[model samples]
Target: MSTREEILGAAQRRLNLDPTSSMADIAAAAGIGRATLHRHFSGREDLLTEIGARSLDRWEERLDAARVGDVCSSDDADRLRATLVTLLGQYLEDSDDFGFALTDQFVLAEPTLTARGEALAEREIELFAAAQAAGVLRDDVSPRWISQACYGLLVAARDALRAGDVPRRDLDTVVASFFLHGAAAPGKPL
Candidate 1:
């Protein structure tokens, strides 16, 4: 891997473990000297800004892969297609760093991170609106609220997996199921 990629990877891991970790700490974690780290990234904030941007960019890609524009076709069918399930499953499998940055107090407090969160929310709102218009999702609840709740569920499932409360293999299933059906049991009255 390139030095920059190595530093970002190491930063993601270290920041996830402790958002308050210093640049020196991250350098040590990355097995590089402070000067080398600084050469790649100006400082802690600069590195964090990049991390937040990269994670958000990844999620945007995932959202596109989920095919938000396919709401019409999905609603024309009786059930949601596998594309959504597959996309969400990938989110659960690969969004650990994204989740980590999102849940971190320090990261969330960053202005750039907050802006990224807003953009993410807007993207989700668009997706939800498309689905709701097609009758694939309920329109009674605000899309923004539902999106937030769904994300909360994803993060919760991620934490459960991290805490060993649930197996990693089950994380995707749990998140995807909750996103599609919420807490309603099969054949149970909602």
Candidate 2:
């Protein structure tokens, strides 16, 4: 990788461990001097913007690779559920600096970044709507609601993984069950 890429990679790794980490921390992690880090990234905001863009790119690539249309055609609900599991898994496994910064409060607060996030979210909702129209997903649930629920599942799973409360291997099944069926006990109306 180029020096800039290496620095970005290092910064991203530190962000994963602690989103609030300073430039000094990133420099140390990257094994470079602070001046060198600054040469590549003039400031924290500059670095974060790059990371945010990169993260969005990675998400787009993953979404494309999933071939969502094929799965949706086979079984819309299952496809939607599987797509979410895949996304969460990608977030958990990604080593890019942008992925790490995704957990940061500042990143979430940035209007541009948040807008990009929302656009990605809307894509997921479209997928849900496709499933709903196919009758695999409950017609009573709105695409917006299901999209929010899907995001909630990802956040909860991430927190659970960080807390060591849930095993990583169980994430896919857990998320799938919740989205496909829901948490209400059997015989109870949803």
Candidate 3:
């Protein structure tokens, strides 16, 4: 691969392994000298900002490809369950950078994020509203809350994986199940 691609791939691996990995750590993993790494990335912040943008861009692309906007074609619950499993899979895969992207620094750096973020929020709200209308989802919370809760829970799950407490293979099933049914005993909703 090219030097930039090699560095980014190595850096992402380092970050996922340890979010606080140092530039020296990444350079070592990338198999490049510190000077070469610096020749490509002026500083750690510059590398991080670029990776955050790349992560956000990839995130948007994956969600867009999931076609969540047209998710009303079937039984809402079944479709939502399938959709979320796919989404959470992507979310977990990007655990390395998703946390940073949600931070203030990355949020402030990308002006386009606001518009895309608003659109995503609105789309999620619409889906939640539809599912609720279909009598699948509970009406206790607003669509906004449902969307935010899923994101919050996903982040928590990602952190748990980082801590080595959760098994990687079970992440998708566990996350999907929790989103579809949280704290509910068997067939009962709590």
Candidate 4:
């Protein structure tokens, strides 16, 4: 891999483990000198912006692969559920690649990242709204709430995996099921 790519990968892993890591810490983690790291990225914010952009690209690709937009607009419950499973599965499989963007405050605060993230989230909210209108999702809760809840679930899943509270193999299934069905047991009162 190229040095830039290597540094980005190493930095991402390091940040995932600790969001408060310094640029020097990232340089050390990347196995490069501070000067070399600076040559590639102007500073920590620059590196984080790059990572955040890449993360958004990955998420957009997954959304497209799952054909989420198409499924959301349809009135078919089966398709909606299936698409959600596919989307969640892909996200879980790619957790390591995009986890940092969701958790890193600096990345989220970047102007470019904020704009791109809000755009993506707007699409997601529309998707949920369509699903709600189609009877695939509950109508009581707002679509915006569902979108935000889904994001929260993903963050929770990442934390759970890091904490070893959820098995790696079951991460996708656990998250998909929880999002679709909630924590209630069958025939059990809420």
Candidate 5:
């Protein structure tokens, strides 16, 4: 990899572990001098924005690879859920910082990310609608609502992991449970 790519990769890794890390720390992790790190990225915000953009692109790619549209068209709710869970798991494992950054309310508020996020939300809603149509999801639930809930669950999972309040082993189960059963009382048909 190019020096720039190496630096960025190192920065991303460090950011994922600790978003508050300093440039010097990132430089050390990247095996570059502080001067070199500064030469590459002049400011923290600039570096952060670049990282965010790259991470967002990666996430967009993951979503695309999920074939959400095709899956939704099949009206396979379980498949849709599994697709999301798998994509999310990969995203978390590959780029935890990106996941965390995207989940951050303030970062997501940025215009670019916000626009992309909205578009993604629309796509997710479509998937949710298809699942509902398939009778896998509750017909009473709105797609928009379900999409929002999904986003919330994703963020919660990230935060829970970061906080060490939830074990990593339980991540999949937690996400699945939320998406499948929801918060409603048990034994009631959805």
Candidate 6:
């Protein structure tokens, strides 16, 4: 791998493990000197900006691959559910690699990244709205809430995995179920 890619991979892994890790920590993780790390990224903000952009790119790619927009506009409830599950699975698969982008306020709040995230989120909200209109999702909750809840579930799932509270094999199913059926007891009335 290229030196830059090495650094980015190492930094991402290190940060996911310890968000407070310093540049020196990242350099050590990358097996490079601190100076080399700085040569590639001027500072932590610079590094984070790049990571944020890459994370957004991954999110967009996953959405497109899932054909989320097209599925949202379609009348096929089964397709919508399948697409949603696929999209959620993609995020879960990469949660460790890009979880920081979802959790780091600074990364999410970066002006450029913020704009990108807003656009992506708008698309997600549209999907949720379409599903709700089709009776595939709860109509009582706003689309925006559903969209945010999906993200929140991802974060929670990641935490669960990190804490060993959930097994890797069941992560996808558990997350999908919670998002679809929520935590309410079986047969409980809403």
The lDDT-based order of candidates, best leading, equals 6, 4, 1, 5, 3, 2
User: Per-residue lDDT for 1-190 in model 2, tens only?
Assistant: 3388888877887877787789999888899888989898899988988887788787677767877656666665656655656765675554232445546677777889889888877766776777777676787968899767766666676677778877878766776777677889978976
Please state the error at residue 78 of candidate 1 in Å.
5.9
Q: Residue 88 of model 3: what lDDT? A: 70
Find the number of clashing residue pairs for candidate 2.
Answer: 1
Model 5 lDDT on a 0 to 1 scale: 0.74
Q: Candidate 5 versus the native: TM-score?
A: 0.78
For each candidate in turn, give its C-alpha RMSD to the true structure in angstroms. 2.8, 3.1, 3.3, 1.7, 3.2, 1.3
Best by TM-score: 6
Extract clashing residue pairs from model 1: none
Misplaced by over 4 Å in model 6 are none
Error of 2 at 33 (Å): 1.1
Point out the worst 10-residue segment of candidate 6 by lDDT.
1-10
Pick by lDDT: 4 or 5, better one: 4
C-alpha TM-scores of all predictions: 0.82, 0.81, 0.76, 0.92, 0.78, 0.96
Q: Give candidate 2's TM-score.
A: 0.81
Off by over 4 Å in 5: 91-97, 103-106, 183-185, 188-190
Rank ordering of all candidates by TM-score, starting from the highest: 6, 4, 1, 2, 5, 3
Winner on TM-score (2 vs 5): 2
Best by lDDT: 6
lDDT (Cα, 0-100) at 170 in candidate 4: 85
TM-score of 4: 0.92
Local accuracy of candidate 6 as per-residue lDDT tens digits, 1-190: 3478778988999999988889989889998888889999999999999999999999899888888878977878999888888888988988868877778878978999999989999988888888888889989979998988888898998899999999999999999999998789999969
Clashes of 4: 0
